[model samples]
Target chain A: MATVALKSVKKSYGDINIIQGVDLDIQDREFVVFVGPSGCGKSTLLRMIAGLEEITAGELKIDGKVVNDVPPDARGLAMVFQSYALYPHMTVANNMGFALRLAGVPKAERDAKVKDAARILQLEPLLQRKPGQLSGGQRQRVAIGRAIVRQPKVFLFDEPLSNLDAALRVQMRIEIARLHSSLAATMIYVTHDQIEAMTMADRIVVLRSGKIEQVGTPLELYHYPANVFVAGFIGSPKMNLVPVKVQSAGADGITIVLPGGGTAMIPVQSSNAAAGSAATLGVRPENVAISADGPIAGEITVVEHLGGETLVYVNVGEGPFITVKAGGDSAANVGARVRLSLKTDEANVFDTNGAAMVPKVRKPLADLEKRGH
Target chain B: MASKAQKKIGLAVLGWVVALLVFFPLIWMALAAFKTEIDAVSSPPKVIFDPTLENFNAVFERVNYGNAVFNSIVESVGATLICLIFAAPAAYAMAFFPGRKTKDLLMWMLSTKMMPAVGVLVPMYLIFRSTGMLDTRTGLVIVYTLMNLPIVVWMLYSFFREVPKEILEAARMDGARPRQQLLLLLLPLSLPGVMSTALLSIIICWNEAFWSINLTASNAAPLTQLIASFSSPEGLFWAKLSAASLLAIAPILVFGWVTQRQLVRGLTFGAVK
Candidate 1:
């Protein structure tokens, strides 16, 4: 419903900066997620956008109008906090209709709107129950229903599923995605869960230490991370980053000495990385294959047998453990010697500075411009 | 097992003994309220003496007891209401929108209560006299309100802090102004704490004797002054004094007993799971 733009937004407390200058453009109806670890300023940035926190510097615009001085209520936004924050003293219906009542909407109309929201959230039977009487998920639904009744221009969710159990988190995540599509309202969600970001976001803004690390679609980030941090943070079980010695660097590609006495030429532009310098070879668990004829050898340390996919943790020499994703029924036993084959095209090369060398052949789907930003 | 049972019985007996020890004076006073003057002052306190309501009748008839009771009720309740009106907002701001100096401010406010009231009695009395507030119910109410303000604000601040900050932030996002947040959200959430606070303030004001005796001679004198008046130069009227004291404390005793459950609950609000 509205486009939100932040131009060099910064937040600080005394000399400590919580959110460094952040520039981001969220298109109308875009489901943007601010994903980061704890103390990464994701929540603080979301609060700043919601007008709950003061932006120490820079301008924030909604619909192209700077609203740095606007109060939270005047910002036309509704938020669902992690605690649900349902009014414990009021019935579910009253909690949902609170904003409407505050806006001076007629009683009959407010009731109708609440009823409609209740039906949508499947809370019709719980309209009269207090928040204390409801289950955790039901309370979450009421929190969402409270936001829904306001019909605000933007909806902000601050780790709304962090408090729920795993199964309920997935269910609520799906419900939120459906709500976004149904309402088509611009939503800014802040969470440290990468799965939520990967599944629910139209574009994920990966932040680190108050700075924007990268901003792209889920697949774009997965296939082409901007740096080592994004590469390690975006994937499940983390990407295996092994320290490699660069043997040859050229316009064609860079050849790096892999661990356990193996060499692989990764097709990436490495103009900044010189030969004989230390660089990191980044490969996701799924991209590392366990094969008999593979060059890189290691001893299997751990085998995680998930139903659909198995994770094989291999101890390759004195370096860090490398994890390889294999079939669910993978019979690789612990203490057994195995070899890992690196998917060189899918692999990435980061110089000593941790900045990734651009891949020569970009995945068509990783194109952010084609994805409409 | 036998020793455990004996210990349990011993604990029960000890508890009863302690309870009786605490209640003995109240029981004796109640008994004296219904006795003759000679019986009240007799050696060993004449447990089997004939009971009479003559002391109560005489105490009620000799003075305007009804007017003093009315004045006590009005002054205590009026002071509590006025104190809450100021204390709630101050506590809300201190609890929710605290600054670097908020803790220091709250500590300073509580420090005022540590000073003995008599230390400033002369100054307060002179101020009241200059403002033409002597011997008036309004004057007593004002004094009681000021006397209880710091404690009231401290108690309310502690209660308000128990409310989670997230709820208030949600209210702001839901378009509630600061005033609406205080009235509609905070006051209801901390109702139990507020009730206990009002009860405590009213009890303090009702039992206060020095200020009532010093500030008012007749018109605004509360039950404390009424009880004090029983001490005359013609020797201590033990029977009439006991009767008057019993009458003056009966209402508050019953009120406290009725609200005992809520008082305990409020005091331990966040202590339990």
Candidate 2:
């Protein structure tokens, strides 16, 4: 039960700045995930908060007290690294109880705590085995069990499931979500995979090049991203961002010319939204459909059939290639002519500065979840 | 099938030839140790002779050979422990928290072993004589410790490097202090390397001849000096020399043969595949 606040946190090595300046407030029991491309300093930010890396300049407060100078062990935080850095020489039971032993916890008490953590992770039978003796997934569980025995105020996971196979990754993801709900401890997870962020986090902090792009709930980020970067980063087959000319801009709507010489009026409110200027139209895969007389025409480049849905890649001339989510049994094949129609009300418009023009009104949570965008 | 069999037999023959060549000198020495002085030095070398243990009895009865053996064991073991005490912390620092000059510092430490030991003979003798440490086991221990320090540190540094850095970070995260990190994590993880290093240091210290022969007369004499004494003005008694040499080297030879595998592993600890 702790709130972590970073005020203008910055990390730089000599002249090269890694994390420029990050200011974020993490409330107690919030599952905040930092998602970004590789080299975006997401891991660095998590490390800084875990006290594993030094903050070049900033004030970090945890539980309403400054802890920038505190060592990791004294900061009341447990971190599970990408490699699951378990002590290779130690048995699973001893590995989990190591921190307790260091704190002078009595032998019986330490054993009970270890047993509890093992039971939670379902690692009771492997208690006496060393790390080398366990499988990769079991070792990963032991790493988490080690952290669980600490019972820290905050749990920091740095791409903890990245090394696992696909099936194990999915299983571990659900288990981690269950653990978060069961423990009700604040967790800061960092991953480049958007689905993990969308499925697990209460609030997702999108980062790019050492700066936070946006911080919002999954639905808010999906339905109303603050900018083009967030729009392009949040969903599965990323949102298609196409450069187009702004035909006209008004207080209630902005009309942008489409690639095939058609125009659609996007419902956004921007006081400074101008006409005869450059802008981008952001459309998610699910928000665009194939129609016989749709404005945008293109040839299907590829078709991916994912059982219930098929992602058809269409290359409309003079704009970005667009992916349209269609019914799996639809007769969309490579080289077929595809006409794409946008759901205009759900479409987003970005101005010359790449900032998303604010929506006229927020969508209801039920409506947003029902669309499953 | 015929060519493969021929190749295998040829390789086997070459391997035996190499092994026999290496073992010839030790075999000859062993044979001479059990022979009388006359049979030991006979022309064309006696291939067959009556053997006796009188030469060993004479070696013990004539000189204080027991003192030399005791001194050798104490000096070698003491120097090995002292060198380990000095090298562990140094190697730990160089391995985990390296700086810009770390590589240069490691190379400099290893380069000290390249220079000939005879080059420092005069200066070392002068210092030992002036300090009244010329004939003491303590002096030999200090010399042997310095002699073996570089190799010990180098081996340990490489061993420590092979251990993943995340393990140490895990210990640090688990509230282990630096001393505890070294004792609980590093010492156990690299026990084989450390054991090999200690064994090498003991062998080198036991077999060292230059400093022992030049600086010590009676009290600090080790096995090397005792073997050298067999060549005294007795007109080169081959049987007595061989018996003394065998006695002085038997323990270390057995130790080397037993631990040869670990030494090879230590030598090639981090070799790239």
Candidate with the greatest lDDT versus the true structure = 1
Q: What is candidate 2's TM-score for chain A?
A: 0.96
Interface RMSD of each: 0.7, 1.0
Could you tell me how far off, in angstroms, the CA of residue B114 lies in candidate 1 after the best superposition?
1.3
Among the candidates, what TM-score does chain A have in each?
0.97, 0.96
How far in Å is the alpha carbon of A24 misplaced in model 1? 1.1
Q: Model 1 over residues A235-254: C-alpha lDDT tens digits? A: 79899999999999888899
Q: Candidate 2 on A57-143: residue-level lDDT in tens? A: 999999999999998899899988889989888999999999999999999999999999999999999999999999989999999
Give stretches of model 2 more than 4 Å off: A270-276, A366-373, B1-17, B233-235
TM-score per model (chain B): 0.93, 0.94
Query: For model 1, what is the error of residue B146's alpha carbon versus the real structure, in angstroms, after optimal superposition?
Result: 1.0
Each model's DockQ score: 0.83, 0.60
